[model samples]
Target: MLNRFKSVVSNVMGGLPAIPHQTEIPEDPNSLQVKFHYNRPDFLFLTSDEVELTADHISRPILVPRCVNKLPWKAGYAEVINAGKSKSNEDQATAMHFHIMAHMTETLLNKTDNQVEMTDMANTGGEFDNSLEYTYFAIFDGHAGTGAALMASNTLHKHIQERLLEVKDLLLCSNEDKMNDILKKRNMSANVNLPTKRITKDSLVKGALETAFCDMDEQIARERTTFRIKGGCTALVALFFGAKLYVANAGDCRAVIYRGEEIIPMSTDFTPVSERKRIAYLGYLQPELLHNEFTHLEFQKRVHRRDIGKKILCRDALMDGWFYKTVEEQDLKYPLIYGEGKRTRVLATIGVTRGFGDHDLKVHSSDIHIKPFLSPVPEVQVYDMTSCEHTEDDILVMGSDGLWDVMTNQDTGRIVREDLRKFSQNEDSRYTSAAQELVSKARGHLHPKGRGWRMENDRPSSGDDITAFIIPLSQLNSPSCSINTQNGHIPEKLENG
Candidate 1:
């Protein structure tokens, strides 16, 4: 019984290999003294203040006090976690700060993962710029590994800043008509007789964001071997400047804006089920991607090899119901679409359909790749926030699937509204505090005996990692007070054209 007890302890200490970055805890007495190399130092082991940020560096040209060190204001942050490795608590809320120069995503010489950065005002503006400053926020949710998230968090803003800087030139070149319209709206006439260029701010900004996402993914794939980085992550970013709000996302992570009392989505959550049509379309184009091992058809469940030549039930096109048909040899093959909604997976492995990294991902227990089906391009949502009205209660909420799994966007909005109303008299009830409240609700309550956990609704607790950012729209949109809502979603460049 003692030997069995030791075996169980060893297994528990190791956790599951399926969980990314987890390994077998050693049985050796001096194992703690051993230097176990990881892609980056565990933030769990560092104090929130000690974590890196752009503001912390003395070399920052535009030096500013760190967010954590600054006097509490309209915008703030909060986090809670029931899991992770730490000498103390499993929770970590550390954020890194970085300094950005004139619009350029400097090629990072180092490789890393699972990071966060903030900039009060990115230097992305026109020379005759109407807007003086802009703020940027993002959340990188890592899976399989953390490298992609860290790299993207570090460099994506730079790419955007650079692209936005060229807005004037692009506007002159690409869309002379639209550019003239915008200039005319400002009551400024451009020298239309001058040589016209072929790019517009619309096209430039769109191309830059999509390019940055893909570049970051490619960088992660290239550096994974050298950096020993594993896994992949979701990228959700928000760019609020002047009269416009740009929210771009490339995974299951999401961004939403709560204006007045309504819920406005800023980004789309890209999952296997949400992208079934696209996934099926790709599979149709490249049947060879199936490796003759899978079919693009949807069924009640995975079709069995022995089920060949038998009639079966399968789904047809989008929004259509499953129909009865005789199973062919192809039907007997494995399914390209597997799992169910949310848990719906691609190649029967990855749950997310769009994200960064995972370029080298192979099917579980097999060598077949799911990367061909994975993409890093983000869907860009452009919201003209300049013309929208706002209230102090209005906010922008960003969170990973962990929070969404237990709460719908509408439910979350209602909760925030109720909390703000109930705590209106509390002076300390800032946006981040509200974010903490939401995270706490999802985290649920620990058992009386300190065992499992459950939520107020009597539902199960969130089993995945959770993070939330509650940015006050008043704080961000105060001076601007401008426009609102999740407006039209525009794909990048000529892709839409």
Candidate 2:
């Protein structure tokens, strides 16, 4: 399948080629660098400063390092040495957290803008007394600009960590009316009368992830005027604590795990098409937000005033049915959900319906801010990895959409299994190597005999910035395993909506 990043922001932003632009490399490559490729049409990255990486993005892609280089963190990074509530000085688990990137597909932009962070949550001064016990992993895919993605990579986890106590406290407190109101606003089912002791681990984690996204987005918007940061990014993160794994996402990025050969998605992708009703309903409730320029009702193409009063098939915002309605004068307005597929956009100004950044951004020539429609509320998913039976091949793959655009969850699971079968963890080219191979397959190699040639089932590589982490859950099995996630990316350029 052709990997075409939708031009979600192009209606106002201008157009560019869908293919990734590459610069000629000098003979004898100096070094290999893993960079984030924001799937935008514009080369918004201006800085050349090297970012300090916490994951294995800089070092060689070796899954099982043979002491080739000093590991950034101690080996068995995922090993949860602290089994009980008492905080231990030793690092958590031995389950490796390795990040590898291929300089993403974009034109003329040499520097990669994507960022990832994996660390023991203990270091960050979170509100939770047991903060030292959890592990955090996230991938921030930026587009249009790098500032937002960079900021998210550095701060989102901290927000999550800090909110841990707030969420738990809120759930435990007796403030029923306030808690119910908050839960209702988040669209979560509310049961404030339930005793605090009955609160499930899932509820606490969900409240934490949701509240963290809210806090993170608020911070981003506040910092926009101060930091002059433009653009936005999708966040996918995983929080591992005790026996449960919490996965949360705000954009197109994905998290997939294997229950033996069965593929399960830990997070949901928030695209215009998937979020049509919610967006349309928001537009319905607040028509002024449309500025008389867009309609909550969506259509295949633009609706001109000339077509007013014409009968057309339409999707209702409140109902789960498709019916025909006569195009009123209001129906001729620009659609709230514009375009189609990957390119479909919520407001014709941005591609992603949810995520962080774009705070100071306004619709071109108008003071109307699009941030009102965009959100940072992540869909958090919980998995009991601790309860599942383990196999050597059982792995958790978290990747940017670049990997998913070309491969399905099943395809990824199959490839991972095959790679392990061919190259075991005992070999140097283990998980990280398999990740690179998976990236290569999604981002097919260049022309002629490569990705350009397009084989019968051409799955050579991804033209987007490809970053993936292949975690060995089998190794992290120290009586407990937990999880959460981050997601989304803006294209470098967008054609007219």
Which is the leading candidate under lDDT? Answer: 1
Q: Relative to the unseen true structure, what is the Cα RMSD of model 1?
A: 11.8
In Å, residue 167's CA in model 2 sits off its true spot by 6.3
Which portions of model 2 show Cα errors greater than 4 Å? 1-132, 166-198, 300-302, 425-429, 449-456, 459-461, 479-497
Tens digit of per-residue lDDT, candidate 2, span 1-497: 00112343343334432222122222433342223232211111112221111112212121222221122221111111111111211111112122211221222112222222222222243334422245556776666656567666656665665556445434443455666555655553554454333345467778878998888888876765445444677888877655567888888888888768778789888887788888889989998888777778765455566777777777767766767777777676667776656666556656777788776665544555677888889898988876777676677788777668778898888777777778655654466556655655664434564324121275443445555667666655442222112222222221110
64-179 in candidate 1: lDDT tens per residue?
Answer: 11222221233434444333321111111222323333333334222233221222223234232332245666777767544455556655665655555556343333345766
Q: Which ten residues in a row have the lowest lDDT in candidate 1?
A: 488-497
TM-score of each prediction: 0.70, 0.67
The whole-model lDDT of each prediction reads: 0.57, 0.55
